[model samples]
Target: MIRHLVLFKLNEGVSRDEERVRAGVRAFQALEGEIPELSFWECAWNITDRPIAYDFAVNSAVADTDALKRYLEHPAHQAAAAQWREFATWVIADYEF
Candidate 1:
């Protein structure tokens, strides 16, 4: 399996309360069972207020690199990513397990 993790950081002057941000987060949360290539999915808002803490996170797993690619290219995922791109930046890491 492959673990695909992401940490989100709100852009300068952007607040988590903004409609765009909320919608984006919702979109991500809604993908748990929507994508066939995803074996696991979790999207969440951060509870910590520390400067080093990211504003949101996505922890997901896939069957392999090919499945991960499909998940990344899926239209739903692309749309959700587009929404997030409007208000935040993100970092991602992938590893086999």
Candidate 2:
């Protein structure tokens, strides 16, 4: 399987309480059942206030690289990402387990 990880930092002026941010969080949290390639999925807000901490995170797993590609290209995933692009920036990592 492949582990797909993403950490997101909200833009300087953005707040989690905003309607758009809340919707973005919900959109991502719903991906597990929405995407067939996702064998596992979990996402949440950060609980700590650390300088280096990201504001949100997604931890998910897929069967393999091809599955990972499909997840990335999926319509729901794309729409969520596009929305986030307006208010956040993120980094991703993928590896085999």
Candidate 3:
């Protein structure tokens, strides 16, 4: 099994408040059913006061590395990724179980 975790920090000047954060969260959560290799998915809005913390986040579990790769290259994922540029900075990850 492979657990693919990703944390996202929004671009500077972007709001990290409840409403904006929730919209980003929903955008990722909606991809769950659309991507077949996505075994499970979760999203969260960071509420910490730390100076350098991520705002949007995702944690997904896949059957294996191949499934994870498929998920990354899937068309549904590509479409979802297109909606991220406005608010997201970059993704941080861990691919090992």
Candidate 4:
């Protein structure tokens, strides 16, 4: 199995905090149902006091590295990511088990 985690920080005035967080949560949650290789999905809004923290985030579980790769390259994901880039600072990590 593989875990793919991503965090995003929206640029100043680029997005409404609440709405952007909600959309990120919904988009990740929907991936499990929409993407065949997505076994699990979770998203959250960061509220910690840490200065370097991201604003919106997603954690996803996949069956394997291949699945993870596919998810990253998926058209839907690409489109969403493009939109995210317009308003975000991004970070990503992948783990295997």
Top lDDT hit: 2
Deviation in Å, model 1, residue 9 alpha carbon: 0.1
lDDT of each: 0.94, 0.95, 0.75, 0.76
Q: Give the lowest summed-lDDT range of ten residues in model 3.
A: 16-25
Supply every candidate's count of residue pairs whose N, Cα or C atoms clash at under 3 angstroms.
0, 0, 0, 0
Instruction: Write down the TM-score of every candidate.
Output: 0.97, 0.98, 0.81, 0.81
In terms of TM-score, the best-performing candidate is: 2
For residues 15-65, write the lDDT of model 4, one tens digit per residue: 545575456556656666787878888777777858887787888899998
- Per-residue CA lDDT of model 1 for 1-96, tens digit only, reads 999999999999999888888889899988989999999899899998998999999999999999999999999999999998888999999999
| Candidate 4 worst ten-residue window by lDDT | 16-25
Candidate 2 yields a Cα-based lDDT of 0.95
**Model 2 per-residue lDDT tens digits across residues 5-50:** 9999999999999999999998998787999999999999999999
Better of 2 and 4 by TM-score: 2
Instruction: For candidate 2, list the clashing residue pairs, or say none.
Output: none
Q: Which stretches of candidate 1 lie over 4 Å from their true place?
A: none
Q: Where does candidate 3 stray beyond 4 Å? A: 17-23
TM-score-superior candidate, 1 or 4: 1
lDDT, candidate 3, 1-97, per-residue tens: 7888777877777776647555666667788888888888877777786887777678888898889889989877776666666667766574666
TM-score of 1: 0.97
Per-residue lDDT of 93 in model 1: 98
